[model samples]
Target chain A: MIPALGLLLGVIIGLALQPTVPLWLQPYLPIAVIAALDAVFGGVRAVLDGIFNDKVFVVSFLSNVLVAALIVFLGDKLGVGSQLSTGVVVVLGVRIFSNVASIRRHLFNA
Target chain B: MTQIPQTPEDGRDLDVQPSTRTAWRRLLRAASPRPTKGTLLAGVLAVALGFAIAVQVRQTSNAGLEGLREGDLVRLLDTVNQDNSRLSDEIVRLEVQRDELATSTDLEQARAAAQQRLDALGILAGTTPASGPGIVMTIRDPQAKYTAAMLLDALQELRDAGAEAVQINDGRVGASTWFADGASGAVTMDGRTLSRPFVITAIGDNNTLAAAMEIPGGVSETARRMGGDTTVLIRDTVDITALRPLSTPRYALPENQASPSK
Candidate 1:
């Protein structure tokens, strides 16, 4: 319940601010969002397994966002930005899908 | 009882390699229903994730141009270039029209000025008829004693009084008019002989011309002393209809066009 309220507050703040992103940071925002989504799903799965840890959740969320953005930044310098972005999305996408599938299994007992 | 992995102190769950059967047993383990510090931390990360997603969505929609195909972008560029060239062509055409209008106005003004100059020159050269307020004098030389010099003096006095056009009998006075004594002791002007009463008409200010003739020791007095009576009548409109033929110069040439040897 608290996480749901926090997510709603965050959306409201983002909408109210409507901040213009800087040119240099524009390329990393989408990748960071995807990585954050993957971490959130992993946390949910850990919570369902009864092994949720505050330190692990916080560290994993921060590291995921940073590593995803760094990979894309490096790919841009190497002229392989789009290919690397696709790779990152695929990896994070598979993880998110498996975590959601496990969460569904835990909730539904199917 | 199947043991479920728990990482409470150091959070090291990596040491346990759980097989599929054990993972299923761990998934079956009941989660704590009470809110903990880990749940609060997850809530904070959830906020960050939601904010990033919202911002990324906005940025993608704002840069909608990025989603266009290459061919569509090329076509849009082609249309813009065509419009640019067409507008420049219209500007060039309008500029040419403006220049033509400017030159045509200048041409019209030049023509009007040249026509006005021609009219003034015609009147000055004695090749045009002129009418104005002046005096007509009839000199009766009943004694036939009035000489060409006396008549010439009368003409010169009218000129000094600002006469613009002058006519003596049937001849118009011009730049080249001359007076001389004829064979019959009468006055001959430019080879035209005059008889008894000489009528001179001059176009000028009526008051000033009449005063010039009637002044003491002037033309009227001089004529009376020469055994002739002069009659000066001031008229409002004295018309000089006689015109002089324009004679082409025989020996005199315009300085600019004269032969260098000459």
Candidate 2:
């Protein structure tokens, strides 16, 4: 339930920021949203396991933000923003498909 | 016999408690997750907004294109008009300068220099004074399909052959005069309407200028090609001083230089 909530919040952030964001950063906004959702899920899992570390959460959050920004920046500087967006979308799409498939397999395995 | 489990002190089990309606609620909430719902809505709205902006941008760009075309046409016309005005002004200035120089003390010196140049070129300036002994050619072609531009070309050729003074049937050729079709289908010269069978009178050394015109592929030949009538009359001395000088140029040089050459 919490993970679903986090996904909802991230999507809302993406839509709100789309217009204000520059064209170069557009591709990464969706990626950032999804990454944030995953981070929330990871944090929740860590808490349940009684192994939650503040340093790890902060580091992961900061790295995700920086990496997204860097990819967009480099794409813009190389004059390949559109191509980079295509690559990012393909990778994220595949990841989502695999994750969903894994969940489906686990649920039906028994 | 059964044993009851005790609650943990840290409240972990309470946090994970599953109520009777928990599964149904989670499924309902998952089906309409916030991120998915928000993103879908935003994507649809963004597409609509982009469509509207694209339409507006296209319309604005089209308007700008039309405005630029009109501006270019206006600029072209203005440039042509300006050039016409400048040429007229320059002609007037030259005429005034010529008149003033004629009366100056330097006139005699310049005349001597000109005479020397003419002598070197095997030509005499004042020997004949370009008077008498020439054929007057009057060309008239009212029904002919020739244009005024063609007639102007002939006139130019006549002048180049050393015509001292040339006049059309009703208008004297001048610096500012343009030969073009008038509104009524007849040719217009110097803003005056003229009919067919235009008579052109030239006064110069009859033998020399006339012989010059008689050369092959000359004015007579060109007129023949245009199906116009050409008449050349040789006379000992044809007095033709009734022609009026062209109007005072619109822009004359200052009065300081109006003296005739010595």
Model 1, range B110-201, lDDT digits (tens) per residue? Answer: 57767788766666677888888988899988888889998888999999999888889878888889999877677898898986698999
lDDT of 1 by residue, A5-109 (tens): 678878877777877666777778888988988988897778666676778978999999999999999997886887898999999999899888766555543
Error of 1 at B123 (Å): 54
Q: What is the C-alpha lDDT profile of model 2 across B116-202, one tens digit per residue?
A: 776433212112223355456676665565567867877777667776556577455544457888665578886777767777666
lDDT of 2 at A93: 62
Candidates in order: C-alpha RMSD to true structure: 26.2, 18.1
Segments of candidate 2 deviating more than 4 angstroms = A1-110, B1-131, B183-185, B255-262
Which DockQ-derived CAPRI band holds candidate 2?
A: incorrect
How well is each residue in A9-107 modelled by candidate 2, as lDDT tens digits? 544554554434333434455555445434434444344344545457556654654675567567757867556756765665665554444332222
Steric clash pairs (candidate 1): none
* lDDT, residue B232, model 2: 78
